[model samples]
Target: MSQHARLPLTLDQLWQFSLQYYSAREIKEACLHLQNHFHGNVNLLLMLKWLDEAKLTFAPQDWSKITQSLGNIESLLRDYRELRRKLKVHVSDSLYKETLHFELQLEKQQQTALVNCINSLTLTDCEHPHLVEQYCLQLGAERLVRIFIQPVSSQSHNL
Candidate 1:
């Protein structure tokens, strides 16, 4: 009952964009580097990419919930990530690996829920499209790259 189709906009579309832009093997390495070193939120990174792809923006009210929910999920993700890392040393134990895998799946589900929650909100015109780029700049995070557009020798590029 809000605006927009959903959080991800297009799962396949956004994923394709993320793979092409945010998580290309090289870019993903950079992103994960940013994540491990900077505490950046990959889901938020992807969400911002999706927003840009959909040419959408969130209202302040919408962002309040979105940001709050992201905070909660990020905390859980951090905890699980730490647990998984600790468990990694014990990978010879199938239990530890299973636990890590479960944590990974739970993190994915949480991310999916976050996206669904975002999709449930209302969107306004992207007043300053650059906000997507600047969203986490002040937080000392999100330095994975400002642009995600594929280089097009044939067409002028933008993402």
Candidate 2:
């Protein structure tokens, strides 16, 4: 074997290889899996995007809070999924339609809130802890919006 082939990859090496060794779709799937495991699906994606957009990065303190927020979102999604499944069988057609309508409306509201939250982020907020609180609230709100919009099946469509 070549010397390179015998070498164990470091985290940076593995990250680079993983990005190269698979197609973009495969890399995305792996990212989703790891994000879901570490931060739950909602916050991880949001945090990653938010960081990218703001040209900022997360400190350990911020990451811990974001993970906690994502956990809340995961629970909410689970409940909504269960409710949707139950509605399919137990509810009347009219009632089901109404429930779906409400859910869609709720989804829209969440989306708006998320957008507002993203809007709230500014470079100035980085300096103050109180501003960070407001920034996080907006970020959390936006994260839910992203979750509602990006189902696993539909994600590729956006790309």
Candidate 3:
């Protein structure tokens, strides 16, 4: 435990944080690149960003549990995402939008699961910096890490 205690995190906070960052074009591009190129889970990456921003830290086993909790939802999300992508060219604009909306709903479900998982975990105030960068690097997302580490002023232009 750390001296600087904060309120417990919530789904809305994590979702809002993710939406704020993901709204930036450069951040979206970086996240998509990591997802398509490195097989990164976008939700997990966002969760990491949320955790970092909240100054929270968790153990390796806690991470394992989090991932385990998301296993089924991850599969469904992947399937829906793939379907949405494939339908982009074949479906009517309205139909495509519907598919996209459904995919977003699935993403929200994943985020809810993540918030629950984190709530069940033992988290401490951050003892180290650049936790998000380190995790991205471990995933071999060096370029994407820069997007996260850069100042908000720099990213603001891309919003």
Error of 2 at 80 (Å): 2.3
TM-scores of the candidates in the order shown: 0.67, 0.35, 0.87
lDDT of 2 by residue, 51-154 (tens): 33233433445445544434444556547756886878888899888877775454334333333343333322222223223333444443333322222232
Per-model clash counts, in order, read: 2, 1, 0
How well is each residue in 71-117 modelled by candidate 1, as lDDT tens digits?
66677778888877886776777888688678656656556765667
lDDT score of residue 38 within candidate 1: 68
What is the per-residue lDDT of model 3 for residues 53-79, given as tens digits with 9 covering 90 to 100?
666778766767877878898888878
Off by over 4 Å in 2: 1-39, 70-74, 89-101, 104-159
Give candidate 2's whole-model lDDT: 0.40
RMSD per candidate (Å) reads 4.9, 15.4, 3.5
- Over the full model, what C-alpha lDDT does candidate 1 score relative to the true structure? 0.59
Top-lDDT candidate index: 3
- Candidate 1 at residue 45, lDDT? 68
- Write the candidate numbers in order of decreasing TM-score: 3, 1, 2
TM-score of candidate 1 to 2 decimals: 0.67
* Residue pairs with backbone overlap in model 1: 6-119, 7-119
lDDT value, candidate 3, whole model? 0.76
lDDT of each: 0.59, 0.40, 0.76
